[model samples]
Target: MALGVWSPSLIDVVLFVIAAVVVWKLERRRRRGWATGRLPPGSEGLPVVGETLQLIAAYKSENPEPFIDERVRRHGRLFTTHVFGERTVFSADPEFNRMVLGAEDRTVEGSYPSSLSTLLGTHSLVVMKGARHKRMHSLTLARLTSPTAIREAKLLLHIDRLVRRTLDSWASSSLVLLLDEAKKITFELTVKQLVSYDQRKWIESLRREYLLLINGFFSIPFPSFLSFTTYGRALKARRKVEEALKEVIRKRKLEKATTRFDVDVNESQNNKKKKDMLEELLEGEAEGMTDEAVVDFLLSLLVAGYETTSTIMTLAVKFLTDHPRALAQLREEQEGIRKKKKDEEAALDWDEYKSMPFTQCVINETLRVVNIIGGVFRRAKTELHFKGYTIPMGCKVFLSFRAVHLDNEYFDDARTFDPWRWQKNAAAQQVGGPTVYTPFGGGSRLCPGYELARVVISVFLHYLVTRFNWEEAEKDRLVFFPTTRTLKSYPINVRRREEEEGA
Candidate 1:
């Protein structure tokens, strides 16, 4: 009986060894195929986690480009690495990036990791493609960029009032963290524009939730029920946002439904038509869009709108303070506009806004140097061949905006923050022809809120430069990983322009 039992155990062990050998051979063959044939050069790191940690670290580093820079040195511009649980192709080639963006569905598709997709929701404009994307883009573009929309929006006046309130509150304080203050300003403006809500009541709560969600976007995905976990907290934040928005949407729908049969056009109690972006979207729903789609679109708008504008605004101040000449030129332009006004309180109209060419140049320079969106993510719909290498089917592609923006080949002394570079043909050429300067991305996927962001930044710069003078409170620091922000909230000392003049 002992002999028989030992023999059976030996047989089981032999079978297990045979199975292991088979798996080993198959994996070896697969790796050989990847190396000898189509896939680009690079290590994917260990399985499951891949190179995620390294990529995250790079983003968090002071010089964020080294992540791609080091890899490009080893494996050329287009190389493969595993990121976010999938094999990804990182292309720092500007021409290639422009081509892929222009190609759209013809060569690849818009894709994000499941974590991001889940957070953004199914109906987000980020995920929409082809005909659906075009339709949504058109709808959004009409409302966001059209001359009529800009004229009717009166964004500058509202932004000015909001900025005044913010500065007034900070006047008593000697030091102000500009990045933190800028976030509050942008968030308030975005909320007001999107839904016409009174932001004073909701801004703090929404800001808290949005912080959680943004962090979770780049955090490693882990299954957890505890709110302390990144994904769990993100989910909780999403729920809060959804609940708050659901009520607003419901109320708007009620208003729309209640006014359907009125012979004369129904209006608010003040006898005026609703003018917010939400009102425009609800009208679309009346024409057959879903409630979830509207909510997702609105949330995506918030994601696109607030942080980027705030970061750039903070950077603008930083760069201006460092370069006194640029600051003087900026002030000259804005001051000229101010002189055109009847008084400091006079509203900035569309004409006045468009006339500030120098201010626009400063905005562009800030976008370039800061590289707010370091890259754009796309996935191969099929095998893609470029520059004599093959990008395999379904691989993720990172169009490195940072690489293109800072490349010496594209810009003379690209590292410098010279807004005047934009005033010349150098910067404009980047946008023309091959389209290298993609601060807002390119093709049909271009950010619908680009013009809106421009308006917001310009207005903020106008008020800040013309009203208050500020200087760095200490040797300020910044980080670019996950996203661009100050090492410390970017504190600075502020004094009124009048006080500066008197002193």
Candidate 2:
């Protein structure tokens, strides 16, 4: 070896190689628990990558259930697998799922991929924890379900008007992508409820940005600065969404401040303005919540209200279309309500909306079959034990609602699109019990907008069945990866029922 620039000798090279191997082994063991028999039975797959590729691949295929089903067969309902750069426990058992969800903030906390957390922001309700999460969650639920909100006749009238207008536009269309139309209705409804903004151009543009943001939820989390990457584009979209929301908040605050005492008392009494969600949050129960928190909170609601509800609407229509008997029955029920109305233009009331037992059954069946949310990701806050298996602290736990919902053990003919099942089974009527049915999720994190979602979908279905007849424009299939949506947006050719009757 040269004095100034010495090359490694054989012993030194051997020792370095040995150290590298040891470190790699330790990392592998740490991730997979190679030395412990306590972790659930399963394989971690290839190091670093783990089963993420397989998971993604399976989800992209026509049937995504096999990924869990196959694993469950081999490793039982609760199994260990490394996915999304972490050691995760996938639970297919309804009892265990209930326990995990019930354990929120105590033993487990909300967890998601880095991509989702980044897009949703630290202040988002989905990622929020402890008292902060509890406060916001309660506030959101109260506002959404309050007497002045969804339960009000005015709000129900608004929803009916929006659904009617949307379907009216689709009446003359040669081709309609049901999913896109559903999104338009839901986005407008959510925006109106949130900020009282209903301008077509602004809602459309913001919805486009939201679509991009959603695309990145299941994408690679790092290297987000690269403009071309899906995650990168999603981040950009999120920023735009945040800025747009902030501007809305700014304008709203300004307007409120400017008009605080300037209104004529008589005029104000004659014309009472309904408070939107933004207004509610501004004067929120959760004290001292910042603008950023408000933005993130509203963004989360937008995602839930717009994407998930729209998807449900589309899937409900598709399922109804496929099962003609169910469709005929649903149409009859909706038409019965329509006949009782004063006139064709009269809007549905809260009582009428709640009166649709068959509609609720249809919505429940759609949620069960489609499993729009699929499951949730929860991180174990401490070492946990369940049914003799030990879950190490910090392990990601996936409560597979899809697995539970579709299990033949819980639901008879689980794969069938049977709305009548709800009518027969008493337990199925309760939508979020966690043990058997959890379409809107379970425990503390159950969706606040579940009832609202039902209302929106029910109203849409009422108008759709009463006014229009539609058939598929082309065959399309459901894709579950990233999100559950139709490959072709479920295009359909629709005709007004009056026109059809006249013909």
Candidate 3:
């Protein structure tokens, strides 16, 4: 970098070479230390500008998992990469996953691309680590996820109405734009889940803006200036949505509006008490959860809910379209559930929802096959030694599913789509636990809406599978999600088939 000693052309090459040497030295150090204890194996890849952009670009086609698989193939299980000068490791061992993603590891919780943090902002539980992070989780659990609230959430009229409207509009289309559908559903669901209906327009605008910012993460390369600009616009769009959300909170806290409280209430009363997720956020007993905190909280719920549910839905429909037999089988099973003894229908609440083991299996398998995030992230709380290698305390780590799901040792016929595998062949074992098959991530920071997601998917999918026919659009367009994979527009052929739809 010194001007007198080196010309710019020479400087670029010199700096790169030095970076390569540093990576080689660290890798050798890690590999040599492994004799003292066991360690996972992988590569840091080539050094370039203190980052792995080149490596990622070169390998992104069959990227993420392929990189992990290739590295694991060459380096074994646990391995280190010094790309960007970070001694990062991509480990597949379940125990290692436990060390990084499981609870009690705070040091490695918050190290990610700044763009990621920028996208998540302060409201996200994903980026924050330690007591504050855990506290945020607790605050979420305290009010929004309480048992009674879950039951009441089902009765939310706005959500029910929105879902009905959304579905009704889909009747004419041969192929529904899956991603758009999911965004609409997620935005409506989040608003329905987190805030009031008065701000539906703002919430919608926010969803669009977030989508743009989120899209920039993967489709666009970094430096993030463009993303920041998109984010700035999104911030403006977000302001409109936030205004509506904050207004509800302001109204709730200032007015102490108990008028909206009531079980099995008619529409009039529900409107007055603020029956949205925003209201529940307002109702939290946390000592100092600010309005901005509440706003961030609501925004995260929207993004998380939208990204996961929408992508999964797109994949499920796509998979089912490819595997017609499975689709037919699932339809039969759903029909059977409907024709069950009256007692069974009565029992088919949340408990019965879980009872649909086959349905759950399909969802689980789908997530395993198409995990949206390449891996789960964490940072070292302090310098730690696993096996024998010293992971300089504060080294960021990830337990990638890209490698784990495909590992032949763990999943038999891992590449095949057998929805019944979890129910029949693999029924004895659980797919996701503390460390393995972690699509929603793991530990105290595990996705809070996992259950809600399952429920909505189950119900929404139950309706789709039971009542309509589905097929891929004639042309399959690639959807470019910045940090996520969702359909840009999946035009699936659909048609309603009976008295259930009230023809």
Q: Write one digit per residue (lDDT tens) for candidate 2, span 223-330.
A: 655778898899999999999999999998888676765664546643554477788787654258788888988998888888889889999999999999999999
**What are the lDDT figures for the candidates, one per model?**
0.79, 0.85, 0.63
The total number of steric clashes, by the backbone 3 Å criterion, in model 2 comes to: 0
Each model's TM-score, in the order given? 0.88, 0.91, 0.79
Q: On a 0 to 100 scale, what is the lDDT of residue 270 in model 1?
A: 39
Cα error, candidate 3, residue 433 (Å): 2.6
- State the RMSD for candidate 2: 5.6
RMSD of each: 6.3, 5.6, 6.4
Q: Which is better, 1 or 3, measured by lDDT? A: 1
lDDT of 1 by residue, 1-503 (tens): 89987997697689867865775566456556556347768888865457888987877777767777889889987888877766788888887888898889888889877777788888888888888888878877787555566667666678778877888887799799998999998898888878888757677888888888887886655554657788889988988888888888898878767667553453454355557779877655325767777888888878888888888888888989989999999999999999878876777778888999998888888888887777788988777888778776656898888887888888789888888987786444543246778888887888777777888788888888888888888986687666664455888998888877998
Give the winner by lDDT: 2
Model 3: CA > 4 A from native = 1-51, 58-64, 83-85, 103-107, 145-148, 155-162, 198-200, 216-244, 251-254, 257-276, 283-287, 340-348, 425-435, 477-485, 499-503
Candidate 3, residues 1-503, lDDT tens digits: the string is 37766786586689768866877777567556544543344544544333367445534343344555667778767776654446577677767776666545444655666545555566566666678778777756554554455566563333335555677788776567766786688666766566545366766666666666564332323333333555554444555656766776776675544543444466665456435655555555333778777776666666776777877877777788888887887777777776764753232355546556667777887777877654765666766577766666556676766567667787888877778777664544443465456777677776666666666666666667766775665766444223444455777777777643666
Q: Which residue segments of model 1 deviate by more than 4 Å?
A: 1-37, 261-274, 285-289, 430-433, 485-487
**1 or 2: which has the higher TM-score?**
2
Residue clash pairs of candidate 2: none
Alpha-carbon RMSD, candidate 1: 6.3
Error of 2 at 124 (Å): 0.7
Worst 10 residues of 1 by lDDT: 263-272
